[model samples]
Every structure is written in structure tokens, then in C-alpha cells.
Target: MPKSLKSRGGEEELQCGPVFTVFAMGTRMTFVTEEEGINVFLNSKHVNFELAVQKPVYCTASVPKNIFFTLHEKLYITMKGKMGPFNIHQFTGKLIDELHEQLGNLGSHGIMDLNILVRDLLYPATVNTVFNKGLIPTDKGELQEFYQHFETYDEGFEYGSQMPEWLLRNWSKSKKWLLEVLEKNITHIKAYKSEKDNSVTIMQAVQDVIEMEKSELIPNYALLMLWASLSNAVPIAFWTLAFVLSHPDIHRAIKEDIASVFGSAGKDKMKVTEDELKKLPLTKWCVLEAIRLRAPGVLARKVVKAVNIMNFTIPPGDLLMVSPFWLHRNPKYFPEPELFKPERWRKANLEKHAFLDGFIGFGGGKFQCPGRWFALLEIEICLILMLYKYDCYLLDPLPKQSDLHLVGVPKPEGQCRIEYRKRI
Candidate 1:
């Protein structure tokens, strides 16, 4: 049934009933899109985030079953603590240096795949920011290759989750490659961190929580963090920049806004500050709008305890799923369900910048993505830097999302080439 939904493109498959039901491989799942059901799906104490994600998290990663529950919950807190504003503020400048380093490799005028550019920029910034310098190769070309392997591993994630890992040998290899690298990074940091820079990394924090004898779990946990931090955020970055560049008005307005805060764009590097980054409403809105349109089509959580939603009583063992793609399309909350209007955010019913109804791009409730602010800030930084340092326009039509996948930020269906000239 999930395959049927994945094989078929567009909304018709998702619009079947008030509460859609799917029976796949002995798993019973209920999908919710309406107001009450959606709230319960997101906010219900019965919904279990770790358990729902356990299948995929275990399948794709090397994390052993015995420690999955403890490691998953512990790392959730680790990620939240490591990516919170204080940690992010410290790494902002370093992350920008990584981004600029990649940009430097792209000459003054060229046609480049926007997807590749996003991967090249974000993969290194995230890896280097969360890991020590020598932990992973910091060179742009090496990082690009690293992300390519991750794409291969990620491409088979859903299928791997549903089926056995041994069935997919090649995907398994990619996973191994990633884990090996992560393992080396963790081991090196733990062994030599005190002798060297002694600067703490996210992965360093991760290494601390895990037991010394349970060393096999190090890379597995590191892999989990890498996937959470980069997998969706990278594509979301692509979509955000693509959306803004597609709308000339929005692009120009955000450019001017960033300039007012960061000063005029020149050959010199951008001097970004957290306070200045906070001043960008338009840039922030465009990122939100892109996320609204291209967010994960389905997010499934386990119905741990019995919960009533949309007239149905979800039992303890069932799965509850929500579609941010369809939810954000509701005209009641978003007005124009399909159109990309960054300004709609200004008029929505928002508490603490979250839409009370219909929207859950960063997710909702206490279990919202811990890297939410960092992800947004990362996207916005990319937008401002690219927009400020270069005059970029899509050389081809904006790429569309692969309708076949629904788990996370969908990768572009094809390459969208962008031609940019470095600002004088």
C-alpha cells in the first residue's frame, strides 16, 4: 500500500478519505490531514517518535538493537543541546568559512548543478561544524564525494526500512562507507582531542555520552546525527534558494534586505552576525514557504498508548502518519494552498512563529526537530551569501521533487543548472 502511494504521483493517492488507512507488510497505519486528527497526530502523548522511526533508523544505520532505544533518546537530547542557539552561535563563522570555501571553487561565471552546489556547500559545513577538522576531509571535492555516497545510501532508505538490509548489498556498502568514516572521526576525537585544539564538536559531544566498551555504537550514533542534520536540510536549502531565485521580486527584495543588514556585497567576504541574521524577515519567510511546499509528505509515529483521533481509536501498536505537504495546502490556514507566497506567513495564525493550524514544516509539539533553528539559519545563510556574493539565476527550469518519495525533503527530480556571475 505504501508502494502504491509511492509509485503513484501527486495528491490523489493521499486524498482518499477523512482518515486514510494503509496495510503494508503486516503494519497497520492511519494517515491524518484534518484539523483535530492532525493535532492529535502531532501532539498526542501516545505518539512515539523514536519507536516509529526505529525501523528505518535501525535498518539503514549500523546501530545495534540492544542499545537503539537508549542511544536514540540520548542522542536526541545531544543534538538538541549541541544545535541549540548557543552552540550554533559559536560555529556560525566557521560554517560560513566552509560555505565560502566551496563557493570559491566555482569561478566567476559558470553553469553549475544547483543540487551539487547545495551538497558541496552544506555537507562540508555540517560535517566540519559538528566534527573536528581532521575527522573528515575538509576539501570541497572530497566532501562532494562523501555526499554522493550518502545519496546512494539515502536513496534506498525507505525500501531498506521495509525490507531486510542483506537484500540490498550495494546500499549496505554505502552505509558501511559512511559508518567507517564516522567511526574514525569519533575514535580520533576521543583519543587525541585533548592533545590538539580541544575544541568540542557535536560528534565530540556524541562521543561523551556513549560508553567506552560499547565502541561499535560510536559511528552508528554519528551516522544518525549526520543523517538528521544534513539529509533533509541539504535539499531544503536547494528548494529554498530555487524558490527565491524563481521569484524575481522575492529574490530582489531579500537581497536588498540582507544588504541593508550586512552592508553592500563586494569581493570581500560577508561578515554575518546572529543579531543581523535575526533581522531578516523576508529571507526567513522564503525559506518557510519553500519548506511548506516541499516538506516530507509523510511522517509516521507509533501509537504507543491508545489515542482517539478523527473518530477512530488508534491502538497501542499502530502507526500514525501526517503529511505536511497536504496539511500546508489547506486553504483555511494558508489561504492559497499551492502558490508560493512568503508574505502569507505575515497573516497566518502564529504563536511563537508557528502556524497554529495546518502547517508543521519543522514539525510540531515538544518533539519538533531539534535542529529546527539551525536548519533555518543554515538555509538563510546560504540564501544571503549566494544572493549577496553573486548574481544567480536558474539556467534551466526549477527542478521538481521526485513524487515517488515522501519521507523527508524530497530531492530534485533532475539537475537544475544555475548560471551565476560573481559580484564585482
Candidate 2:
């Protein structure tokens, strides 16, 4: 047996699989790959997991500041009340308009980098949807600066986790910039009261919490929420479009599905509502399958007490890691997991297959991503309009997955190019 597969008891116990451990930057971490072991850890009550507080294996051993954790907890609570499917659907419509305007500027036909297109459309649209344009920076340079800071902070999580305390102290520049942006936005909203006439945005909701609790951490919470809303969205959108266009059958079926639901496509803008989008099963399935294939990241938890899972005894104070990227491809749940088969998600087949239980692309249990439903709505709307209004194809073959970062969404090894021509 290979050394990688040998368990703590050696090759004789390879059937149990090895529980790999690595020491990085003075922090000890455990990596689990078996399906049963991960499921047990994720669903276990003894395992404690807090997204903002947990010291992810990739980051320094120091715990996040108390204020940061408080901000996250409060924001999560506030989002439960403010972010609903209805609100997300309404935001999706506005997002469609913004994307339409931007795409129009690109002309009728040309080769474009898929990553750039996805970022350009999502960044501003997400800001508007979450905070309203009145609160965000109006200056293009400031906006660009903010975006660069965010990317820097996000990319740093991979290496920062392995750095010591002295290096970690220097990592606050990105956090400071993000907080400054949020503070300015909050001050603007308070002074102008612009959110009074319009629907309550996430910014306004966080402001309310700040007022009620009299906590200074609200601005940081707002910044965290903004990051959460923007981070994984672009990658998910890119993969969804890439996979749909890569497969001839899937692409044709999606276009036909859009035509059936929205009528014959033409020069006029395609107005698709959330209700209408729900009717396109194949389109939704294609997006789900894409996520299962390309979305790679791990769920980290710290054991608060000694726990026994899958006949292995795990000690208290150990870091536990589970990767959905591996779980989603498990042969026990998904047959021929490498293939892109949207039909596997059909209603009748889904009922018979227990694969749904194995699908943890969005995490699981109480720790499940709060923005999941909204994320799906946003992706579906983008895919629907792009397919309906334009004819698009891959200009470059799908690149291998790279940058499997510990904190953020994974990206293609290199740029995936695509060509688009407006359909009239």
C-alpha cells in the first residue's frame, strides 16, 4: 500500500484509511478524505466550528480578534431577517439590467476573457444590490482601489494561515481599507437617509443593528458581509457558463429551454422572472452540476471534546478538515462522477438516488452558506440572459483547476477564453 493511504496503525489498517497530519507555522492540522469520516465530523455535535473565529489550517495560529467574531455573529443573525428569496429575486432583476448595459458596451461579437467579463458584471452589480449605489464610492479610482484591496486580502488567506504572529500583524492593511470603505458608506447613509424611500438594503439592516447594540463592530460586520456576497459568486458564475458552453448537448438544451420559457429570442432584452426561471429544470441542473465539479474548498472545525467517528478516536483541541470537492465526487453517491450529466438531477432520479445527502457544495447543517439560495438565483439569471440574448462558445479549452486556496473559491489554472455574438 502507498504511504499516503497508510493509517496511524500502518499498512495493515489501510482499510481504515490514513488520517494525515501536518505541522505548519506551529499549528497542527488533520486532513480527512473518507466520505463517512467527513459526514460524521460535519454532523457531529462535539465538533465546534465558527467561520470567523476558527483558526483555519492555512492561517496563523492566533485566534481572530473578538470584535471580528462578534461582527460575524451579529451579521449572520441580521442576514437571517433581511436576506430572503424574494429580496434576492428582486435584486436579480436589477442585476440583469446592469449586466445588459455592460455587455452592450462590448459590441455585438468578439473574443473575451471569461474571468474579466464575470468580474466586471458581478462587482458593481453586487455592490448596488447589497448596499445601493448611493452608499458606495462614486469615484472609479476609489472603487478600483477598494477592489484591489479586497483581492489582496482574499488571496492572503492562503499563506497568512502559515505565518507566525509577527507576520500576521502586517496583514491588516486590507482589513483596514475594507473597514474604511464600510465606515464611509455607513456615514453617508446616516447623513442622507437615502435608504428611507427605497427598500431596506443590507447596509441599512446592519446600521439598524449597530444602533440597537451600540457596537463599533458593525462597520467590520458590514465589510465581512460585503466580502461574503462577492467572493464566491464570480467563480460560480464562471464555471456555470463555462460548463454549459463546453458541452454541445448541454448548450443546445439550455438554449432550447430558454426559448421555450421566454419565447423566440430576438433583439429585445429577455425579461425573465424568478418564477419563470424555476420552470427551466435542465438549466438549473446544469448550474448545479457545474458547481459540484469546479467549486473546491474545505470546511474546517476544531474539536472541543474527544470524539469517536468511523471507529477512529479523535482527540480534543485538534483541527478537523473536510473537503466538499472530494465528497461531491465520491463514487458511492455519484456514479461516473467525472462526467457532466445534468440528467442525474432530474426529479424522478433524485428521489431514488441518495446523492443529495452527499452533496455538500454549500456546506451542511447550521454552518450551511446563508447566501446559497440567493447565489443560485443570481447565477441562474445571468446564465438565462446570456444564453437567450447571445450566442457564445468557448475560445479556449477548459483549463485545469489551480489556486485551490484554503479560504476562497478555486480558479482555473489560466484564463478561459470565450467568444460571444449577439443574437438578433
Q: What local distance difference test score does each model get? A: 0.77, 0.68
Model 2 CA deviation exceeding 4 Å by range: 1-18, 55-65, 68-74, 85-87, 134-143, 161-172, 189-198, 347-355
Off by over 4 Å in 1: 1-11, 138-145, 191-199, 347-356
The numbered model that scores best in TM-score is: 1
**lDDT value for model 1:** 0.77
TM-score per candidate = 0.91, 0.85
Q: Estimate candidate 2's alpha-carbon lDDT, on a 0 to 1 scale.
A: 0.68
Question: Once model 1 is optimally superposed onto the true structure by TM-score, how far is the C-alpha of residue 214 displaced, in angstroms?
Answer: 3.0
RMSD of each: 3.3, 4.8
TM-score, candidate number 2: 0.85
Q: How far is candidate 2 from the true structure (C-alpha RMSD, Å)?
A: 4.8
RMSD of 1: 3.3
